[model samples]
Target: MSSDSTKPEEYLSKINEVRTLLGPLPEKSSEFCSDAAIARYLAARNGHVKKATKMLKETLKWRTQYKPEEIRWEEIAREAETGKIYRANYTDKYGRTVLVMRPSSQNTKSYKGQIRFLVYCMENAILNLSDSQEQMVWLIDFHGFNMSHISVKVSRETAHVLQEHYPERLGAAILYNPPKIFEPFYKMVKPFLEPKTCNKVKFVYSDDNLSKKVLEDLFDMEQLEVEFGGKNSDAGFSFEKYAERMREDDLKFFGNTTVTSASALLTNSDSEVSDSENKHLEDKEDEKIKNGTLESSLDTLEKPKPEA
Candidate 1:
């Protein structure tokens, strides 16, 4: 016998090990019976058949061996053409195995649609992508929750037929003035003002009403004015200019440029008048006391002369 040839006893031992781990593989469900299941089955048999703790742990370890770092999008396209299925392992942010399925497709539409759909489906569930070639595959076997349970198989022919009826929506377009960019600015400043006051908050770039709504919900009106310009002028103020203005003055007292200046002038004038009036009143009081003392001294001198 060749040195590499396995003895009958060794072969039997390996088979027994497999049988020991998994209760006999279910005869009816080949699709559902996975390697992890076999490991769990054996672990369960070794202990009380009712308790699955050991089996579950061993199965988890087996599943973790193939965890991948990142998912690739390109390989998923190729697998779709061959009509062969591919599976890969991926890990999520929480460190769970993410098993991904790669569906085979013959056409571009079939492949792209599947890829896009899979990405959308896994957005909330999976942590990272593992591989991408003919078909995009991810590893998601963590905690024995099969992501494929929710997946719907898209055949190539069906994909082609659907692609004809419904043209795919293009990827979101980049805008010079996207509503999202202005949303934060609006939101940060809208709450400080009433609805009537907010109407004055002009939308410079886009007409999207959603942008306006976002601004209304998140921003204080006073803060929003600073974003537009320190003062409403013909030339809009840059952010740096606005910052400089804020640094130079107290923002709380400086709501409107015209009103703030006017208030400061009025306050100074009122303070000066108050000080002058106080001085005049003090001088009059001093004069009255001097007159009273003089009258008392004259009265005392007259009384002494009369006695002499």
Candidate 2:
């Protein structure tokens, strides 16, 4: 093997040593990219490029344990700006179909490039959903990738746009392995959503146990019956199972429940408070302008009488 090829293998051995000490990596791994790209990312992090390549290659080799049946790239197609279609095919896992799209040679910017590539694939695949099944759910898993720098409001807006465009046909679930250590921004804006639409939204941690903790903190289990119209008997399900059901059902059953009603009211009240504060500030400014004008007029009247 060439020196370049051998370097990546050397790096892989080092990564394996670290993993052995730390314990096995997470079940889901990062998506595949070129060795050069992987090397660049490693170099940026002061990591050994060869070791990263070796580790990544080992990970890829381990992925074959899942026995993903290879499908033709031509099975899935996307329309070009010139009105032509490009085709690709991905295998099905459980009930979900998975596609792996390689990024263009020009786009070698690492993390950002991967994200952009994934988004592009999702959009193109979404356009072809009509050709597939009607009641399809798209689960885009981002494994431990940090997107904390992206504005939550902007993310929410993008989600809303996707939801509106696809309606029942489209739903996105982000799985952050090792989990992103960021505050829950989705919770703040969730109330702004209509109850009917809110059913479609889910912000979940990859860890089921952590997700359970989040639910307990944010929502009352006993209130699920009174608030969401779900029977208390439903508590028998595991947190992960329950979340899956919620995503699938689109929160339709939750409509007209006490919790949804309360959430809507709270959202309205928050908006009203913001509006009131803004109005009060404007009134103060207007009053100051009027007082200044009055003072100027008084001075003119008092001083000009002698001249007249």
Candidate 3:
């Protein structure tokens, strides 16, 4: 933890100071290493340049050791089979990619396998992002999630990596049907989350209005699974089929393959979606995505950075 000051000028100063501390970063890491990158680290460390610098250095080391960018869908078949996570073809109202995770399907035998799959899902989601999309919306369905699926160490590591290494990649996270027993684990993990990250998290129960509206508004029902309050549930829940569809997502969005149509997704035979799904609703047209803090200057400061 660092100083509590959050003025924009203080942030910029701390950001530059942290840069001076790091001296030289890996050439390849520059894609995510810049002034804006410093801002994320600075904010995460609560305006402490020294601590932010240390965190930045550790992230650079972790990035090299993990080589997260190099992980691909083919390498994480076991995790995929667990059906715990997947990236959707559709985007939220803000055009951010949507990643679905069902903890009930946690069948991975080892922590390594579980962590690898999580990274694979993250990488594929990044790869599938459109040019304008930088962040992602996480839809975590906890229908069958219980003590058996709960790993305190794994949960803490997940929070650490996402906030420290990834930083600012999360747009919003929705927790659907979180059970009563999950409260203790929630308390443990809550302290690790940055205040900003905590604000982005929304707990959605079946009887709640927030849950119904969030699903209907940001996401296309046709693309959502039944358990998550979307239309497709039966055979559509198959991770194997979804994995194959993500390959097409990479081709249509990334460079995996060529699409003849001007609209790659509209004609995606495997998508089983509609043309309307490709359209993004205007920001002003939807109030729910606005986070109800329309006039806050601090919210303005959290605006998306220019992509590297």
Candidate 4:
């Protein structure tokens, strides 16, 4: 963690260092290069300016070539048909977005497709984060899960993509009701998880009162699904409904970015603008997302699994 003094001037100075090191950033790189975004990368590297610069530069290259943000839901809709992964309709007690994943619901054989869908979900989750919240929670339901349902390669690749590109974006992940057979598989992938990432993962079982309390504390039982020991008992995921919500969010994201880009250009034109002034303006943009002006459809995103 950076010291308290690493704000305003010092923080913006580091951000500028990263920008200078990377030279000219790629197109559509504003959000990725924002003060908040750069600060996260720096923190992920424990405030090492050069290291953070390298990491952010690699991500910028990836974003330019891989185009993770540009991945449309329609391209990965088939991978989602089984409800393998989707943004949760609710946030945790801390107001962090939730992404619910079910391994047993795996319906695709293409590893590339699986990774693409995961990236899509990650990008969408970020788009939905509340202004003050920079992370998300992952609830992995293990009911009916078995060794056969596991894919070690995909697991490692998933860990790589997440830790490398989406630094500091995971607040916590709860592995609910994992069976004994899943232990070895977890052990295999454990090495792939950075200590920071591994610390956020917890194993909880319905039969264990203490572990079960983890969920109780993190979620409003009324909003959490019954499958996770919460009160909500609505019908599980509807692909058609979920797709509609994602498409709407995609439209909103593009629309909002256009206006934001324009605003950023106007603000950035003043060569003498102070760091505090730039931060103030960017904060206002973030507040709009939190206030639902350019918000994600996460509030109504579907959950659970037709496949599970």
Candidate 5:
């Protein structure tokens, strides 16, 4: 593989240091313990080996606890059906995966469910990555999203998960056509994000982002939907179709096992974790978000399956 300018020779040293800190990962976690994986932690820590090692161990423990990769599409189907969040078929000019979210389609009743849904999308995005790309960009379509959709706890937890467990994976996050009311909620969520991560967020007014640099220069118009200035905007994308594709991919990934196991939550007895621990989940908490009633909104949402 060609050298990544963001990762330098010292990255290997940092990786080794963190590896020494965490000890050997399980055979299945080979991907999680690679040189490049450790390099990402180093970058997240600004090359400080000790800090990087600490962060690495914490994230690895979280990974063992969370097992985000193992979450089945079945558990997230209801949220995905809303089409509020999804992995777009196209990549940006730099090959980073593109994720689209419609804040108005917040139909799920549970906060952990929503976070898990987004995590499912993010994990699927990584699974769909080409060898060259390691990051992603989020495009939050704020159209029709009123104040009711904002939740401080959900926002804080989402940002925490991204900054903590999934460090160094966000290439950029662009909020498109945010209404004026979004500012207050956005401000509340800003403090939770890392300074490095906060810098990657961009707010674009429709009038401004309609310019060539966004749709034309940063992305190939033909690869995207026309709503986002791509050719496929008119081509209706269905949750059923996308989920079917994901299921097929999963079949190949799991060697025909349709249902996968849910990740076991953290306990004191886990091998790597038992050595010591800084923190653990207190309890499964739900954020109280008052999303507006879905009246005419169903017209825009995808029905994952006919309710019984």
Candidate 6:
């Protein structure tokens, strides 16, 4: 950690310092980089400019290659069919978006597809966030979970993608009703969780009133899903409806721009955007990041840059 102080002017100075260190970004790279985004990276790294720069650069590269923003709901619709994960219709007490995940609902065998769906959920959650909130809440139900559900590879990758690319975006992760047998699996995944992230994870059980109180403090029972002991009994996840919601959000995010859809465009089947037109749209998207209107974050500073 470079400094414990969090004074505003100083924080802005750090953002500028990181930008200077990063020098000029590639044309496509600036699409999501902003002062607020840089501040998140700095905060995650505890106010270190050099470390934040390196971390932010790596993320920029990942975003370019992975193109998380380009992944539309139509592409990952299959992975989400089982309702393994979806953005909850409700928000937490602080108005943060809530992402409901049920491991027992896993229906896919493709790890690659599973990861893509996770990223899609994450991006949707962020897109729906209010200007006042930068983080989202994760409500993971462990009902019917067993050893067969555990995948060490998926666990590590989840931790890496969230921590490395999303930086400080998790307000809290409620591991609700995990089985006693889940302890060993959790232990295996613990090493991949950074100390800061690990501290944000809460293990809540239905039998433990004190532990369950954590939920009461953070959520409205009426809005939370019934699986988590909440009042919402409409637990059914309709793939058609959820896909419709995601498509709506995607349209809002991309506006009239050409979206990279695996299936035909849901909004307008009659029209198609050409490659040159798509580039123009991307150029406009880059301007939004320069204007610092988009909400996104990255990594931090303090540690020495690793030897090349």
Q: Write the per-residue lDDT of candidate 5 for residues 173-211, one digit (tens) a residue.
A: 778778876775556445445666777777766577454
lDDT of 4 by residue, 1-308 (tens): 11111332457877888888878754687667888788877767767788888888888878877877767766677788978899888899999889999999998556566787899899999899998777889999987887556544455467667877888888888999998866654664454456666788899999999999999899999999988998898635779999888888888986532222121232222322433444454345435434534222222222211110
Lowest summed lDDT across 10 adjacent residues in model 2 is found at: 299-308
Candidate 3 residue-wise lDDT at 19: 74
TM-score of each: 0.15, 0.28, 0.70, 0.78, 0.79, 0.80
For model 1, how does the per-residue alpha-carbon lDDT over 110-148 read when each residue is reduced to its tens digit?
A: 323444334323321222332221111121111222222
Higher-lDDT candidate of 1 and 4: 4
Ranking by TM-score: 6, 5, 4, 3, 2, 1
Regions of model 5 farther than 4 Å from truth: 1-5, 8-10, 209-212, 234-236, 262-308
> What overall lDDT goes with each candidate model?
0.29, 0.32, 0.63, 0.72, 0.66, 0.72
The alpha-carbon deviation from the true structure for residue 84 of candidate 1, after best TM-score superposition, in angstroms, is 15
Best by TM-score: 6
| lDDT by residue (tens digit), candidate 3, 1-308 | 11122444557767777878888766887766666567767766666778778778888888777776655455566567756787765677778788888888886445554665677677777766776555789988897776666543355456656766776678788899898776655654465466677777778877987667877877777867677777866534576688788666556654654333322222222222332242132223223223433233123222222221
Distance (Å) between predicted and true CA of 228, model 4? 0.2
Query: What value does the lDDT take at residue 300 in candidate 1?
Result: 20
* lDDT preference between candidates 1 and 5, better one: 5
User: Where in model 2 is the C-alpha error above 4 Å?
Assistant: 1-123, 127-132, 140-142, 145-148, 152-157, 171-180, 193-308
lDDT, candidate 2, 1-308, per-residue tens:
00111233444644454444434445544333333334432432246534444544554453444211121111111112111111122222222222221112122212222222233344445434443332223222233233322322223334443332222332323222323333233343344443434553344553466654533443344533221222345333233443343233223422321222221232323534644644454344334333443232222111110100
Task: Judging by lDDT, tell me the better candidate of 1 and 2.
Answer: 2
Weakest 10 consecutive residues of candidate 5 by summed lDDT: 278-287
Cα misplacement distance, residue 176 of candidate 2 (Å): 4.1
Clashes of each: 47, 7, 0, 0, 1, 3
- Candidate 6 error regions (>4 Å): 1-10, 256-308
